[model samples]
Target: MIDTIIFDLGAVLIDWNPHYMYRTLFTDEQEMKDFLATVCTPDWNEEQDAGRPLREGTDILVAQYPQHEAYIRAFYDRWEEMLGEPFHDTVELFRRLKISGKYKIYALTNWSAETFPVALARYDFLSWFDGIVVSGVEKMRKPAPEFYQILLDRYHVDPQNALFIDDNYRNIVAAEKAGIKSIHFTSAGQLEKELEGLKLL
Candidate 1:
């Protein structure tokens, strides 16, 4: 039986669009794409999600792309806007799961400390979780075995009894390797089906 349900925040509960922020500053589509590619380079957001300070990451980006210094700053300046809105149906699903009292709900997200609180303020649904393990705050990120182990230890949950959901395939694979059953989240409908398949609902 699945005793716990771990959820990914962005792309799962909320609508996050990197293009929204880039579009605000860069009118040219190709230029905006390139800028996004540069800013979200593996080393950049990865480090930030893994607990690197926001200012430090921003400084690195600024140093790398001096031509867009102001724009780079604006990226973090308008960070909240990138989180478009909560998906009401998904929020409702979480609420239902919580109220069912069938499983312990938790949030495991790869988020920067600076951005997490801002998102929490806008989306009250986040408070529903029994535990929230944020990468930046925990200094560990998805796809890392240590991070999942941290959740396991903190919650005192058995890997076989846990179900982790994420939009990223690699994260799901990692969780599976750690002995936690996982689902690559695509949509609320798909998630519902997966839960049903496991007889969680």
Candidate 2:
């Protein structure tokens, strides 16, 4: 009886990876790993994802790790290089759902507010989403119960009739905690099968 579908943007649909860009910046593979782990860690990036200004985040990181200033600046300066575009098979399913006119399709993503516009401009299919709740825009990222509530409240989405798909297990857990059905997305084919099993495809 699900009438709404929520999709996580990164990993699930968009193949966004810092490694894609970092591969060019550092010649040493171990150094790249060390830099990502210690200098520009995921925790640091998540703060930006939670509505911190990109410029401010970049400057702070630069000051904290002065040795990595160039690399830190490159993270946002050449940000688009990280985008690998949308997964075609999953997008095909989304388009099918759209064409059927039977459900509300939405995007719930934890992306930086400043850099997200680049994606909107590059991906035409983004326009097809009935609604989008960006963590950066809301100043709250996923895995937080309040963030999910915002999506439910703002969109007036019926929790019982919604199906959430996210590549991150933490986000999936949060969605389930909010009383929405969820899928820990892996492949496009797997998602199609899940939708079929739900009789939503």
Against the true structure, whose TM-score is highest?
A: 2
> What value does the lDDT take at residue 191 in candidate 1?
86
* Backbone-clash count (model 2): 0
Scored by lDDT, model 2 comes in at 0.92
Per-residue lDDT of model 1, residues 1-201, tens digit only: 788999998889989887888787888999888877766565677788899998998898888878888888876788777878787777878988999998899998888887888888888888899999899998989889999898889989899999998999999999999998898999999988887788877
lDDT of 2 by residue, 58-107 (tens): 99999998988999999989889989968988889989999999999999
What's the lDDT for residue 68 in model 1?
84
Q: Give the TM-score of candidate 2.
A: 0.97
Clash pairs, candidate 2, are none
Query: Residue-pair clashes per candidate, as listed?
Result: 0, 0
Model 2, stretches more than 4 Å misplaced? none
Q: Distance from true position, residue 186, model 1, in Å? A: 0.9
Q: What is the C-alpha lDDT of each candidate?
A: 0.86, 0.92
